[model samples]
Target: MTKTKIAATSDVSADKVLKSSANGQSVLVAKVGDQYCAIANKCPHLGLPLAKGKYENGVITCPFHGSKFELCSGKNVEWVESFAGIPLPGAAKKLMAMGKTPTDVASFTVTQEGEDLFIEA
Candidate 1:
């Protein structure tokens, strides 16, 4: 994986959000506690930048459509799984059969090197 230095520890606060550019992509960086997390800055649903969203309870809600994604996992709200069942060819049944929990979004790798936050590319 490719990594890029994005910010310093003192640059972000717990429960705060910021937008950064790395690996030719717009990344949304969030600081939760002492940990930093990164995800695509654009909302998966409509290409709106997630930097404009509100962060609360470790989740970010899109400003345009109110779509909520987990800061830690970048997964969509639980309701997305319910809604995804319709066209995925037995997706709900498969989820139940595998005893696997479904998450509606994708997560990016985040690492801290000393006091800096880096995201994988």
Candidate 2:
């Protein structure tokens, strides 16, 4: 595994997420409590950049399709629950998903060295 420096601890607070690149792929680094979690910056549903999404309680919500993913485990919390900004029903959500299965986002292990954060990629 390659350890890549992503950001500084002082730059990311408990409520914020920082976007960085590691192994030539965009990654979103979030601080949850005192732990730092790294997740793929792309949304599973539409491949949209997750950095523009909302991060709350360790979950990131996709801005385009409203898909939610857990930061630490890369688990899919909610999948395709909405479109654009409108809430979709069960049938509508399924249709909007376009046959794409609910998938977990890719997560990486983050290590802190002094004031810098690193990810194993």
Candidate 3:
């Protein structure tokens, strides 16, 4: 695995979101409390950039199709709720029918060295 530094620790704030470039790809980084999380920038639904999406309470919702993901695990938040009989949209239903997995969204490992943040490719 290759690690690339993307930003400074001070660049990110608590409960704030930011986007950076590493390993020739865009990455979404969020600082929640004292922890930092990094994930692939693109949403799997329509290839919309997750860095451009809205982040709240550890959840990142896709702006295009509203496909939500857990920032920490890079897992689809909708799936967990849907399995409990939560009402999902028609588009999401179709995506599930098409066998779209949460793993479709790429994710990376994050590390902080001093004041700099690094992401693994």
- Best candidate according to TM-score: 2
Candidate 1's error at 70, in angstroms?
0.8
* Sort by TM-score, top down from the best: 2, 3, 1
In the range 1-121, model 1's lDDT, one tens digit per residue, is 6889877877777767877888788887787765688788877664667787678877887665455798878888732222222322366545432453444555677888788888777
Tell me which residue pairs clash in candidate 1. Answer: none
Candidate 2 stretches greater than 4 Å from native:
none
Model 2 per-residue lDDT at 28: 90
Q: Candidate 1: lDDT of 13?
A: 74
lDDT of 2 by residue, 1-121 (tens): 7899999988887786788999898999888887889999998887889898888999989999999998888899999988876899999999999999999999999899999999988
Give the higher-lDDT candidate: 2 or 3. Answer: 2
* Cand. 2 Cα-lDDT: 0.89
| TM-score for each of the candidates | 0.73, 0.95, 0.77
For lDDT, the strongest prediction is: 2
Query: Residue-wise lDDT of candidate 3 within 82-120, one digit each (tens)?
Result: 322354676766754356554446766678989988887
Candidate 2 residue 17 C-alpha distance from true site, Å = 1.1
